[model samples]
Target: MSEPIPTGCEGVDELLGGGFERGVVTQLYGPPAAGKTNLALSAAVETAARGDSALFIDTEGISVDRLEQLASARTEDVEDLASRIIVSDVLDFDEQGEAVQDAEEFAEQVELIVLDSATGFYRIRRTEDEEAGDALRTVAQQVTHLLSLARKHDLAVVITNQVFTDPDSDRARPLGGHTLTHWSGVVLRLERFRGGNRRATLEKHQAKPAGETIQFKITGEGLQSVEDVP
Candidate 1:
């Protein structure tokens, strides 16, 4: 069996009972500046640092500067590690679907698939049809496809998402709704923490109880546990 993959964060790995399972899908959601992209990039960095490949199908452009900064501390040759990490950017939902389909080509070499912001275009292209019938269906189909790829290839999958404000509760929730929550094996909600840090709450998990919380800081060295920094 493939080994469970570490997310490059000690606290998150602890929450997952070591790390992410090969066939599981992890969903990360949070407000702006909550470190979603940093987490996603860190996953890629972790994979590439291990001399494995990662396919990042991005709906938004990745931050190259941040990626370099994260990789430098882990490996002597940041360029080599970055080379093993391939990035495929999609402009909208149609392109996003196509990108996932094309990802199969790299299955043999890739250990992880990070789909950053799974619902970017869905949010933008959503019709006045409040139910978003057709759009929601697309999200379901694509997510299922990604999960199937993970299981068949024995690779991990991580998908980030934007948040939507719940009018009734005045809370921010993951954008893809039940479609995302149903398929993901683990779901983490990131929020601002005290002292320039972030908190990750295990909102859902297949094998673990929910509501576990951990606080960490993001820096050039990557995500660091700040448990003692009260």
Candidate 2:
């Protein structure tokens, strides 16, 4: 078995039994400003800091400025840190799929792969219920392909997803439907808390019981795990 990749956030690492497991797909689903991107960047920084390269696929226009800031905080040489991170800006669903599928060329170089807002383009094109469902189906298939690559190459795949609130229950659910849920090996739901803190709930894990939560904060340095979080 491959060793887990540490995410740099102590609390999250502990919750995940060190960090994200290799050869599986991990999904971080939540609402806007829930610190999903922060966590993703934190993982990338940790991966790069360990002398391993990371592939970051940006779908929702993730801020490069913010990434640079985080990278600066994590390492002394921001340029070297940036060099290890291969970023691909994907504008549409087709491009997103292509980027993910074509990542094999970098498989030996990249140990961790991140897709920020994997469902962003699908959500944007979803005008009607039928269209939304169809888009989701397509996206799910693409995600499965990505996961297969992860398993084949022993890469850790991390995907950030957007969520929608159910009108009847007022409960937030990941946008990609049950198919997406089933594809992911680990599922975490991020939420905002008081005092600029964030909460991450481990909703599904292949080896562990669900409903475990962890606390962390996005700081000037990066995502830090809060000790004895209340």
Residue 64 lDDT in candidate 2: 80
lDDT of 1 at 159: 87
TM-scores vs. true structure, each candidate: 0.94, 0.95
lDDT of 2 by residue, 140-183 (tens): 87778778878988989999999988898999999886888888
CA RMSD, predictions in order: 1.7, 1.5
Q: What is the C-alpha lDDT of each candidate?
A: 0.86, 0.86
Any idea what lDDT model 2 has? Answer: 0.86
Put down candidate 1 lDDT per residue, 93-120, tens digits, no spaces.
8899899888889877899998988888
**Model 1 ranges off by over 4 Å:** 127-131, 228-230
Cα misplacement distance, residue 85 of candidate 1 (Å): 0.2
Q: What would you estimate as the lDDT of candidate 1?
A: 0.86
